[model samples]
Target: MFRPLVAAAAVAASFVVPPAAAAPTPATPDQSASAQQVRSAVTELAEGLSLEEKVGQLFVTYLHGQAADEVHPGNQRDFGVGTPAEVIAKYRPGGVVYFNNPSYDNIDTPQQIARLSNGLQRASRVPLAVATDQETGLVTRIGAPATQFPGNMALGAGRSTRDAERAAAITASELRAMGINQNFAPDADVNSNPANPVIGVRSYSSDPALAAEFTAAQVRGYQQRWLSRDSVSATAKHFPGHGDTDEDSHTTLPVVDRTVEQWRAVDAPPFEAAIRAGIDSVMTAHIRLPRIDPSGEPATLSKPAIDLLRNDLGYDGVVITDSLAMAGVRKMHPDAEIPVLALKAGVDQLLMPVDLGLAIDSVVAAVRSGELTEKRIDQSVLRVLRMKFLRGTLGHPLVDESRVDASVGAPQNLAAAQAITDRTITVVRNESLPLKTTLKTTSALVTGWGETTTRTLAGLLGGTALPTGGTPTEAQIAEAVRAAASADLVVVLTNALSKQPTQQALLTRLLAVGKPVVAVAVQNPYDVAHTAAPNWLATYSYGAGSMAALAKVITGELKPSGRLPVAVPGPTPYPIGHGVTW
Candidate 1:
């Protein structure tokens, strides 16, 4: 059983920024003085911290538990502590990142998450920045009870900055209600390569200018103060671009061989836009660009690569590294030296190191041994503290858990999510669309990448549902085809058909069934290039909002208005803005 607790009583009223001027704009003279005062206050606080505590302020770590007091053996082995509260007390990290991995189980419900957040804060002396990867498409960590907006690519297809802003604002509000102050979101990557495994739909568009526009809009949205509380900090991620790589950085290091000129044209615009919008943090990519840094190191550990962000982009905000536990940052260096190299490379915050204890000790030792100067340590610490102060984390680190349910996944937020995704249904081929007109007495079969997705869409349409796994077994494919034989319309959902041969086989067999077939690309729109389904549509996501919007479009209750954010390349190529309107 879970209990919702009142907000902690330690919140400082002086740190709250007036709601009217919460968005980061060019400071007025008075605002500048206020900012200076914040810097001075943060400096004074930093001066009082012990060396170990100051070093601890540079890391954002994670542990496996839902409740603060829950004991886990992994936590005991890793931190010599049995609970999250104990880890926070010992290390006093600057922040903690939440994940929804069932194995880790750090998040469960709105009430539970708020309670956990308050508990963690109570354990730390200074306030902690509770963060999560609530990127809100295929990458969303929190489900259902939170509004699920169609992701960046969907916004790209709709080409609406207002939608992007509204989506991000709603997401930020829910995050604050859950006691989270930072969101690693609004991925600024321009998805130039359709084959990019990690960033396909996460990116807003392939066009640099469009990606930049949406990135700036979302940054403004996330940082806009809501309900008189400080806005959540938004991070524009995978800086220096993770858009062209076909590999997943989590598994291994990816090399992007673009020349500096090409990188500027294709990758740098969105991050530049993010900086201009006053983004609170910029996350480094685990990608190697030999042309940018001849030393052959991934950007997360390369001074030259980071200098591009610091010097070239003129961004002075916090620079956070993508997870240190990733193989991309770990394959070339020993665990103990990874954080040291990252700090040396000019990163301000180390996120999710493989071993938290080792990372903290290494940085502390480096500072004491003159490998890293205390001034350098103070440089990062001041930035972290300043961010905490400006973002209202220092003022209101706790949320009234009892009121969390009222804000998170609110009815208005869900409606906005549905409205946004409603405009994102892109019709590529419509030979058999507007099912209402095509079939007077209709029987339909819904089969796709996710079992829940197929069943949910089927239930909406009152159709027979045959759910297929990611790599559909021959038996699943045969069952789908057999189920489709008696249906008036066959709706098959495809996710990256270019990679899933089994799904491609299933789609091909369904197409041959001779009934009107509607193929929907639920994950990546590029899946359309691999199939010859005469009727095709793309929802860009399989979230409940997207599925609801998709069903309305199929039933002629809504029109298809979304354009393709990226080109579909194959024997027959679709241009970047291709979409058919009925």
Candidate 2:
């Protein structure tokens, strides 16, 4: 499934210069000092911690109100709880995972987000390494005229390594301004199928070499922490390779049939590249790779898989598991057993452990019973401490409360989102006029399929909602068919923020209409690629910025300059990697 960006050598990518970020008033640890002073702060913080506290530093937690007394957000009540400080202080959580939702969402402009994040940092006992899954070109938390960026396969399309590198650097810079330090991105999963239910647009390519190169460049660009170099760290994900599976791991456990030898040569390349380039973290996917461990459990709970990451790939960084509650491991593996297996399997820290007290009890019990060794626990703790040590978060003094407003989304952050959106718009199939100069008729049908894509396209494209039942029912399809027969064009949208199943249905409906349908895959090229209609433009992500880019590309405001990152197999019954330029 991995496809290499085979373009001739040339630097390629887009840049969005943003307003200078105001430095957070040097409150607690005085970040405005020389390297020596910062190092001194780090050292002072590091020297006093016991091994238990040190090991505790590696764990990352959600800012949700897991506790009973936590104050709930008035809007989006169930989304999460606690401010950044509460999460850090209560659990002594090493870091915080920034998840998007109706509450505390990342959909805000980057400037707003940057200031919000600054407030979060000030609340932290230590400078918690802020994290999010902002893989450019697909699955971004940011949006807007600053929005559009191509996914990995699009970068692979131009065979341009420089494009991948620049996008990575840009993504890092934007996030840094907003105060996010970790990006669990540039999915190294080598997507072999255009129909791969989950990993398609997110993966770099099915070609291991290409995945490796793209991932390497992306990490370097995202990691330049000092000066102009973006200080944000990169976390290459789903370590033992998840792209080959056709099944969706979010709902079901997707198993890969490849043998260890096969994976070593194919699936392991990008991780190898990431490690070589000095990445900070490696997040595991909820995938089952049997050959690696031979144990019945998925790769996440398998010792061989985690050990291979260390001994085989030589990754000395922290190894974190995907959400514990995700279906892949939750239903099959009882909650009590998950943490133990992960720890024994060599996973350093558990993420979103819903049953925290139980998890801690289980691990502690394992140690008391000699089921798990103290030495192993110490090693894991050491890894956690080392990482925080590197981040300069170990022993910084308390952050001030006065500067809380300084951190919301930052301008540079929003600019980066807009820049990527502008560059990642790939015009896959353009028939009549490459870029339609005029709408001809404003009465187009707008169907919102994915979450992020809908809001963006509706506002930018100026299309009438596909009536009340836009869910694409049988009646809706019939109506759409009749409308397409008479209307100027039919415009369908899938979330440019995250790809989902609804996008699949939307494409099927448009294809059934059998009319001149211009589809925008706000998610990934894979969203629209699976159904090869006459006109398909893939934005690779659904950010307001990216959606704006899509509208621009459709109307010739921004040229359709990007290429597909991964191959969108034509009609599939044919083969993967199928693409014919218009």
Candidate topping TM-score:
1
Candidate 2 lDDT tens digits, 59-92? 6655542222235462123223344444454455
Worst 10 residues of 1 by lDDT: 1-10
Superpose all Cα atoms of candidate 2 onto the true structure and report the RMSD in Å to 1 decimal. Answer: 9.8
Best by lDDT: 1
Give the alpha carbon lDDT tens digit for every residue of 1-582 in model 1. Answer: 101111211223454455454555321214655565566566667776889988999999987799899999878988899999999999989999999996578999999999999999888888898999999998999987988888999999999999999999899999989899999998999999888989999999999999999999999889875223536888999989999998999999999998889988999999999887878888999999998898888999999989888888877778999999899998789999999999999999999998998999999999888999999999888878767766777666789988999999999998898898899989988886687553347898999788889998988888888889789999999998888889988999888787889999999999999988989999989888877889888889988888898888898888899999888887557899999988
The TM-score of candidate 1 is 0.95
At residue 312, give the lDDT of candidate 1: 85
- Report clash pairs, candidate 1: none
Misplaced by over 4 Å in model 2 are: 1-47, 65-70, 73-87, 102-127, 136-138, 141-159, 177-179, 225-230, 331-334, 395-419, 435-471, 492-516, 524-533, 570-582
TM-score per prediction, in order, is: 0.95, 0.75
lDDT of 2 at 415: 64
